[model samples]
Target chain A: MSDKKISTAVIKRLPRYYRYLGELLENDIVRISSNELSQRMGVTASQIRQDLNNFGGFGQQGYGYNVNHLYKEIAKILGLENHYSVIIIGSGNLGQALANYTDFEKRGFVVKGLFDVNPRLVGISVRGMDVQDMDQLKDFVVENNIDIAILTVPKTKAPAIANDLCEWGIRGIWNFAPVDLQISNFDVVVENVHLSESLMTLSYRIKDSY
Target chain B: MSDKKISTAVIKRLPRYYRYLGELLENDIVRISSNELSQRMGVTASQIRQDLNNFGGFGQQGYGYNVNHLYKEIAKILGLENHYSVIIIGSGNLGQALANYTDFEKRGFVVKGLFDVNPRLVGISVRGMDVQDMDQLKDFVVENNIDIAILTVPKTKAPAIANDLCEWGIRGIWNFAPVDLQISNFDVVVENVHLSESLMTLSYRIKDSY
Candidate 1:
């Protein structure tokens, strides 16, 4: 797979395609034309063809995309086959929620520990995993080979925790904190889920309709 | 504001600029050159200038952009001044998290009701609001002037609930369900937060780093 040459835009769209294909597989749909997929995804058929073409043109000339094959290929491309040790920091509602989300576990992100600075949250069990103290984070991350840390902490605590996570050899940071915590000079990737921003987007879109 | 012609790509970047400018305002910084902001945001200076230019160029000649002015303008453009009544359709961990999340309230998205179909979850308290029955959804949404419905429901239930919410005059959907629910020929806008895809993106970026 000559994936290195693919654009970031294409890479982002791969997951959506992967998801849709997964649904198709579940429904026992063997193949789908780009036009059908385009209508379903609200994207152009040509765009789908072009994106798939970037990865050696997975679509057959007239057959469109093979559901099972494309599903597996996308999963492989997105590194879904590789299992990652995950930890949820900040045992708040959102943290516990992510800890409870079985979808992440199904996609090869295994939650090994949940941590928090608050003593009330520490030692509380969520989804069969006990909430550990922040004190245990460094050792737990290093020893267990934790690959990703989900930051659900408040804005004030996020940056320092992200920095420490990077230093502790955590590879990826999935940030839900309101603030942007970009840690450079380390082999760390930060992906933020800014709920506030998403809400603002909703407001922007529906303001005229209202 | 003649914002009708602005591209969706630029609209997506506005929240980020709004947030960055907000931090600048909080720090007592009244002005910023696009170059200075580009360094912090990892955006090109020219791109920042072009994006803000779409909103009538809030920058000053040789003096750079007025942070407070840009912040206010972005807020207005993103429709942040408007208060929106909201309801959560799933009273599980994710739904409860959104209910407890203070940032949504701060941004004027007030959660008016938390609802679920599960018998055990119904009438439970989450952040002062009682989790209501799914049977109450239609009436509550209609009478409460609810502007948005956050669908944190399971995958099987989200699409049907989204359809009902649209029918009940709910203006927007912040979907966390794995499924894509598109309601056309209606006054509804969907903003999805697919945690699984985000995790996949993180995996793709850090596959070699690990």
Candidate 2:
């Protein structure tokens, strides 16, 4: 199943499935049919079945899927069981918020450090973690097995910082900067969280509703 | 074009197109072929054509699309020119970051106020806007004609706050809460920014790269 080719669309839906299944697990639901799960997820039942089948169908012919098993399977597929050591590249408000966000720890992403170029912010402590100077980033990455770097720096600074992170051996980047970081030459994987794009999406929906 | 029904997938892509076209406009790229635009966007030329055609075919048969014209069209479709008066429901780190984010103003979303239940946070100023009390939310919204509510409240408090916003005649909600808001009964539009989902997506991309 891991070797099987999965479409980007299917991959995108995995987190939603993981989330819904997590909710079901919390509710102590033992099993659920494709129909029920699809209804809950606002997707078609057949589409749900097709997506699950992409990763070797966990659902049975009639008994449906075991909620806990399915959730665990999705979690494993998402690499949530493998704890990731993370660092925030910018100690701005968003970075600070993310560092304080305790939910990441429950899902295996442990933020190790926060870094900033601002002298005023360098000594500040956020959520029990002291902000380190950007100059120390490479050494810290080498010392700590940093799996991901969350980029929250200003747009002007994002590209250079992203390049530095890549050169320093960061495996993944969760970029919150407005600019798209072009560092494809390195082996680093990136996920750009364009907050403005999300806002535009919401605006479109609002306009459509009218 | 406005009357035509657009799929959610196409609607989602509009922002990406808008962003790309904006960059092109900045570079003074007046006209671009579908193939060139497709290469830049990582989508098929035909798909790009299809998307634009859905919105009245902004591109010519041979000359392709006029960058500035295309961008303005997308902006119109997204309702970006119409200024939306917004308020942040929580003044936490994320909320503060958003309130201070000046880019949204350029995109036509004006931050009217920030609201909080905590007495300590209320009356505090953020990005020149005073944090208003939660009790004053309804009156403020009415007086200011607030169109959107940015929900950065705790997950436990999100649902009730969302319901309250909907009842108070808010047209749209940009939810940053971790929870999947269930508010279908009301006529309000919602766009949930599940930061964890984005993290999971990044994790998956990293795992796949490995």
Candidate 3:
């Protein structure tokens, strides 16, 4: 279990399990069988067991998983116990929305800076942080030790900014732009959040049923 | 191929393929083999064939698939030819961000209405539409015929909102709130966009390699 890294699909389900577990914990529930968790989460019990088994055997065969111990294990695997220094790479609506997000800090991610190409927005304050020019990104990343970047730029400008962000030693990018990036020989990881694509999926599903 | 219903996994991947096809079409790529498409998409060649075959046999044995024809077929299957009316619940930061998003229109989905519980925001204008009170949700859904509901409420309130939206006859929900819904006895589908989980995965990947 120590050497077996979790799959991407299982890793994405951790927050969901954590949220449900938080409710159970608040209600003073001490333990939960895999079946109960699966029923509540609308997932198969076997699937839940398989996902949990990726890290280690947390749940007892007959009893269940200890609530607190499982929570700590998930937190450690998700890197939630370690604080992440983040910077937003655009000052548009999406970036501003992210800057105003109160949930990130609580989830162990702190926005240290904001960057924009526009000169007017560069000097303005958004959610208590001054928006800096794109020219300052390299120095800011190096000096501030920024580990995570949120890309909210338009489609055309995303890849260039991504390349520059990688060059500045940024390792992770949460990209909101609807663009597929092409980069090489960098430690950077990009997660594309295409809003249109998600909506399109909804339209597809609804259309099929209706 | 015609008898079997397309899997949800295959349906989800259609948008990804559509995007890639769009790029290929732009570059004047008239035909593409399943192997080529799979390699470009980071999926197995056999998987590409299986997904396509589930919809219809659009590919030739040696000549491969006609890119334009395949794109059209996939688009038709995904209901992209028709426009979808979308309504947003919870006119908070995330909702505001989604309302201002113009990308959906490009992909045949229109943001027709915005709803909120806050009295202050109810009458406010956003993206050419006035934010309506939650009391008007039923009428709006019936009159405008909202095909999808975008849930941007906090985690604690997500389930209730989902239930309300479901009862209102929404066939699809794009849930931004970090919770798995317990929707019952409906054709409604929920896709959870857990922001923290995505970041956590990125962090874990970076940590694993570093």
Candidate 4:
């Protein structure tokens, strides 16, 4: 593998490629060319090569790439080997739902805590975890060493909550709220996940397909 | 405005651009150049111009673009003019949270129905709407003319649910499950919103930022 780092965009697509490759591997796929992978990903073959080249050369000229090795390499680059301790802010429906979601554990993310501003929700158990008071966030984060914060709070409170999350030493944030947040001088990586934006994109796709 | 349609990628980014423009409009930004928009969007200036140009010439050579009009035009093209009926499959924590998510109403999508296979949850009212049995999906879709289906079911059940949704004539699906689904000829748009993928991306970003 090359010493040069790959872009975040390329890294983001690695999970998708990895998932596809997992399926292919399960189906006994030993080798695959860039062209075939590109077709499956709905991207150009050259683009696939370029993305892979950023991490290092993958396939040879004639033999294509080894499926298992490619999967492992991608998994390593994505930091999927370690269990990520996560906390959900807002303890609302979204937070509680995510806390209960079984799929995260399979993907190397563990929900360690759920925090909320509402006193009524505090001490309530969702899935197996109790809803902790938002005031205890710093203590919980420091105690558990939480690195990921899932921002499922309302739009009005998202920014302030995000700031708190960063201050509490959360390294990454998966923002479900629609608001944009700004944080400085911290290693916090914020990824905004907008439901409306995804739905709107789907609507446009539906209209276009017709 | 030119008659040529924009690429799907550009179309998806239009809403993001519109959101930024909305902020600009609130601050009384009357005109914006492509360079400024590109900086805000994290894309190339020429790409911004190309995306805007394909829909129609919104940018002037030296004068830039009118923020208010551009925002409205993009909104209209994305069909945000009217509210769309939506059905959420699997009335678990995630589905209930999405049902209670107020942002959907703000973005012209209404969660009218919540469906589940569990008998206990079937008659329960969440955020003022009754959770219907999965058996009623076909009728509910036909009567309400559901344009969107939010699939929050388990991965194994996603494809079966998708099949039922397509048979009921639904077009767009916001898939929360981590499975790839294939739907036939009915303009099915599945937007895979995998939490694991998002988390892994966040992990990569955190590693890179340091």
Candidate 5:
């Protein structure tokens, strides 16, 4: 609609809306009112209407939203149609697990390569891709047009590797490292996955429920 | 603090504050003002004050908050010292990876055992713990007094398995399964780790930045 930038909170919620709409689409649900969608999503109906309105109303005044159409629009906004060439730095347990995760392939994130510093792990194959040596990282990224680097390295090593990845022109980072990465100057986008934080939140919820 | 219950938004942010304070404690930073914490956490100073005030004012007038004191308080609120015994269902790549994740142990979650339906994987060891047969899951959980079950099973099998876990008296579930579990008439807590959702959010952020 307007040229105004979307708020970060709205941006964060778009994926959730996409996921819920996808489920509705799969279940052959053609349309959903804001109230119905909000009930399923555990959010207020007014909030749902406000969020969708930011992206040019996909819903009708009374008939509500077309599930398939809304899902497509959200997917397009999320860049899910753009096939991103991704590489994992650090062939550790988390790295290998993510490499073996088949869900990414269906969502336009292709794991092109996995890199590691350990020589023993270097030549090893993970999910049909050989773990390339760390020395080959820069060249591999440059040649393969890898835009995303998934960092699962140890906390001590994460910062240096993140810097290296950024230097090699990596546009995005999905960092699972314990420490927050320090990338100041670059236009790179980062998504930090702090597993402990999630667990802590869970613990709090469990405690609160009791 | 008033008798009013803390909102879910404030509950979700407690862990992040705990984490930031932990880092400050590690760095021997004794005290931090709300403004300083807000800058590092990317939140407004007033928001930080409001969040902290929900628990009880940890900050003093003019004199900043003590990092160690705040960290301990948050950890207490999160029930981190409860020592929850955890079991992983489905010893696949994700399960094994999480089993080997040593971070959970430090945060009071102990990985007691891993389970799988595959007979071949039953006798196998993951992160030094033997993978148990699916039949042994209930007995193992009961014997160990397990509180949390990590579901890494396939999407199709997730709902049934989650139901089984809940029926067996499991208190909390850290679900990595793609499908959202439908559990009613139970006191169980669930925290879904939707990997695709996270990636989609990242994709949206990247797309928006460009």
Candidate 6:
């Protein structure tokens, strides 16, 4: 890794680049020029060069970028190489879907447990493990050393549940709740996935086309 | 709407503003200063003013903004007032969750149907409607005049299915597949939700913190 600090925008684009490159590797493409990549990604060739340059410029003069090398580099930078114990709170439709998503396990986000306060949901089997009640949350987090929490609870219950997760020493939060979880007090980071916002964006574009 | 083209960054921020304003309305907070809104949203006061100015500035000097008025304006600008008939093109776990999500319907995105290729899933009920087979996709979309298709299919199927959707007159797509659907040939918009990318971002932040 380079000693220079990278902008948040660059960090955000890294995952996208990683995705595109992974596809390229899957197709047996071992090398790609910046221009070729730009066309596929809908990003400018110069922009791609500039972004990769932040991490020591993976391309040679005319040799272009080595696809597998670049993919591995981004994966390492994104910390996908490490294992993280994850728990899904609010075992609703979305929570159950997350638990069933097999790709996360491949990427090292192991779902240790599913949790909910509802009597109907608790004690139900999810991926071979019983959905635990809220009462068992603290012990589960402590014993399993859960690193992240995927919050899919209702907006009304999101904040309080997030507070509990933080207090129990969860390092990161993948919040799917409608509410934004404020985390200024704890040493934790949150990535809020606002699905409704994205839907609105699509609507905006659709309406614009008219 | 302002005659000048708004930047994509400002367009992205509109949904966040809309959400925050909605929360304010729910709390019975009728009025708020740009500074207060900025503090709650974690955006700078000037930035908020600048973003709003693109839509003819909703603020009144010294008196702040009328929360309800601003919220309504943002909603209208985002095209949330219009009804969009939607179809979930995959009866998988993610697809079913999207079908059950009530917020989209509240905002006028009605799920008219869910589609799948699997025989076992085809006749199953979801939200009072039976999951339709892939054979019905064309007729259902055309007959209902579907405006958007929410794709929750696998990546291998995304591009081809998206192509079919475009051919059948889908105005927009909310894709959950990892693959980016290239739709340059048709006049359609897409919003791809990569859950793994988001999870990777959370992992990146956690790794950075250490």
Q: Write down the TM-score of model 3's second chain.
A: 0.85
Task: For candidate 3, write residues A1-210 as lDDT tens digits.
Answer: 497757778877887787677678878888999999888888999998888887677789888988888887887887778888999998876788788777678768899999999987898898888999998889999999998899988878988888887887887889888777766735777777776677667768777776
Ranking by lDDT: 6, 2, 1, 5, 3, 4
Model 6, B73-126: lDDT tens per residue? 888878999999999998877888899999889888999999999999999999
Cα-based TM-score, every candidate:
0.94, 0.90, 0.89, 0.84, 0.89, 0.95
Q: Write one digit per residue (lDDT tens) for candidate 4, span A41-123.
A: 78899988887776566788998878888887888888877788998887877788888767677768898888888999999
**RMSD list, candidates in order:** 2.1, 2.8, 2.8, 3.8, 2.9, 1.8
| lDDT of model 4 at position A153 | 80
Judging by DockQ, tell me the better candidate of 5 and 6.
6
* Model 2 lDDT per residue over A48-118, tens place: 99988876767999989888888888887888888999999889889899998898989999999999999
- Candidate 4 chain B has its poorest 10 consecutive residues by lDDT at B1-10
Fraction of native Cα-Cα interface contacts (under 8 Å, chains A and B) also present in model 6: 0.85
Number of colliding residue pairs in each model: 0, 0, 0, 2, 0, 0
lDDT of each: 0.88, 0.89, 0.82, 0.82, 0.86, 0.90
For B47-140, candidate 2 gives per-residue lDDT tens digits of 9999888867668888899888888888998999899999999998999999888889999999989999999998888988789899999999
Q: What is every candidate's C-alpha DockQ against the true complex, given to 2 decimals? A: 0.80, 0.78, 0.58, 0.65, 0.71, 0.83
Cα deviation at B136, candidate 6, in Å, is: 0.4
i-RMS, every candidate? 1.0, 1.0, 1.8, 1.4, 1.1, 0.9
Q: Candidate 2: where are CA atoms >4 Å away?
A: A1-8, A30-36, A53-64, B1-9, B28-39, B44-50, B53-64
The digit string of per-residue lDDT tens for model 1 on B1-210 reads 464577889989999998888889889999999899999899999999999888776787788998988888888888888899999988888899889888778878899999999999999999898999988888899999898999988899888888888888888999999988868636899988888888899999988455
Across residues B21-49, which tens digit of lDDT does each residue of candidate 3 receive?
88789899999999998878888999888
Q: Candidate 3 DockQ category?
A: medium
List A-chain TM-scores for all predictions: 0.95, 0.93, 0.90, 0.85, 0.92, 0.95
Best by DockQ: 6
- Chain B structural similarity as TM-score, candidate 1: 0.94
